[model samples]
Target: MCTGKCSRFVGLALLPLAFIAIIVNLLLIFPNGETKWTNNITMQVWLMAGIGGAGLFMLCPSCNAIRAGGKGCCGEGCCGNRCRMLRSLISSIFGGLGSFYCVAVSGTALSNGPLCALTNQTGNAAQWGYHFKAMEDSYLFNKTSWDICVQPPNIVLWHIVLFSMLLGLGAIEFVLCAVQIINGLLGVMCGDCRKKENNNA
Candidate 1:
């Protein structure tokens, strides 16, 4: 049976480990505001799946303790329970974000092929002045089409949004875990003081 102090220490140690996992996941998903050259859709999907699995593994023990009506079973107090819950939630969210990013990037890549073909077929700019005029005319009715024609791939935007959400969630979990660890440590210290007082009495 672990003392409260021991449990608190374990919780404190695990907090950093959990944070590390989150950081690595973020790096894999969004390296330099987009997937790195090493990371493609398949790799990102696998990374996110791993993150979700790790989160669940870290959170399950604490959740079980909480369900058993025990506090600090995972080495912190109720704070440990909260951290575990947050981990699970963020993992699920990241999984969904990862899937969406994969689909969006793949779809955009495929669409660009057709777009390039069309532009090439139109030939020289001087000869395609009429085509450009038609494009401008269509731009009035659908601004999105015009923007898509001019803009490069936009996987970066999706990456930013997803990574921000992951960071925010991870921060919240870290704070809660830290607080719980402190509380558990304090409880152990107080218990020790009471024992000393009783001995003196």
Candidate 2:
């Protein structure tokens, strides 16, 4: 016996869950400052989150209006047919853009494969890129992907990790879009159901 309001609220609740994931993903490994590390997959994640967030914001209002039968609760034409159309347009445009970015990043990451690592001239374990290591001692002490290691056959592990996360986030964006599509479809029929319920009452 879920009312339109309840359904609308449920849809609204999912919006925040995606936002939380975006924030956490950004904070997990992305660092600040204009460095090579910062420029890695961080930029892609930011764009995806921004586009997805804006689309979700627009979609939520449209869903609420549809749940209430093509009209907004404000009674001032806030959720009219035009509003729903415009919201759909905005959601589709931005969601598609966001999905494109997510997919591109994920696809690139997948092509790179897993098990990235850096090795020494003798095939010994070391940070990726010997260029990052200013000296032999530096390589021994600061053995991390964040450095300027330019070692031969450098397979930076940190970048791989971030790329994997980017791919995961992209998958999440697609899932969110799917949910929106299902909700929108169900919303169309829900309006008719509401009318029937009112007539029966």
Candidate 3:
């Protein structure tokens, strides 16, 4: 495939995934669509990995890839195809780093479980903490364990779905960026494939 076109396609693919990551991260702040417990949210939720790492970081790099692939004076004359490909390579690296960050944080949050009001024993009062941290098996597989959170109604299920989504999205974004890195390397090595073909003819 043409390196430029491939890079452009990868960039386009990352766009929606990044947007979804941002939305998913934001939703974590308001469990069960309620804001009462927002103050006591988990540290992962406050980290904004989706918005800052996956969303904005992916966005800037994707835009750069699009511009690098587009037909313009940027890749011609003094700039040269090699320089353009190098730029694309750098952008891909940045995108990969961002997606990796999202993946790491999402995985940690999934394993740690949600911060919610647990079933208090001594008195009927709300107590917030990482209730699932001590579990040997992940709460994701145990449907019965979903009842652990008392206040946010189905918060365990909520965290599972959202964090899983973010993890998957970040993974996909990372793969796409990795592909773009290879494409950029090819572009750099071969210069413009079309230009070479034209010269041969």
Candidate 4:
């Protein structure tokens, strides 16, 4: 396969995934579509895994790959296809790291659950904390258990859905980056296919 063409395809796919991750992560900060209890947001959300890891970190490398993939001089002698492929390899590594980080952080946030005010069984006292985390059974399975986090309406569901999205997106990004890493290595060793085609013609 043409190395530049493959890199360009991967870069194009990554762009939208990174954008979606950023938007989803931003949504986490504003629970229930409002930032009323911004202070009490979960640590994982504050980590900005979606924004920093999957968004900006992946964004830079993806853009670089896209630019490098465009039609251009593969360069002369030493600085030709090999050098470009080397750069693509390095960029793919960075993209892989960013996506892995997003997956880890998003998974953790989903497991620990959201921090919010909870009403006691007595209904007289309410306090802010991780309502689902303390329970042995995962709150995800128990629909009735969701009522404990009373302050942020449907926050349990919100965290579940959004964090899940981040996790899935990160995974897909990781796979694409991994593929590019292999492609880049091949390109570096054998040179881009376009040059071969031109020579044969």
Q: How close is candidate 4 to the true structure, as a TM-score?
A: 0.90
TM-score of each: 0.33, 0.47, 0.90, 0.90
Q: Each prediction's Cα RMSD?
A: 13.6, 8.9, 2.2, 2.1
Each candidate: what lDDT?
0.38, 0.43, 0.82, 0.83
Query: At residue 121, what lDDT does model 2 achieve?
Result: 79
**Candidate 1 residue-wise lDDT, 1-201, digit = tens:** 233333344444444444555555555454335443233332333445225533433454233223322343364343434443344334324433433443344333222221210234455222211122344243333435442332123433343344444444444444444444444344434422323333579
Off by over 4 Å in 2: 1-10, 28-82, 113-169, 178-192
Models ranked on lDDT:
4, 3, 2, 1
Local error of candidate 3 at residue 183 (angstroms): 0.9
Highest lDDT scorer: 4
Model 4 over residues 1-201: C-alpha lDDT tens digits? 688788788889889999999999999999889888677788999899899889988887687667657654446334446666777789889999999999999888888888878877788536888877888998877889887788777788888999999999999999999988998888778766766676789
lDDT of 3: 0.82
Q: After superposition on all CA atoms, how large is the RMSD of candidate 2?
A: 8.9
Local lDDT at 152 for model 2: 17
lDDT of 1: 0.38
Answer with 2 or 3, whichever has the higher TM-score.
3
Per-residue error at 149 for model 2, in Å? 9.9
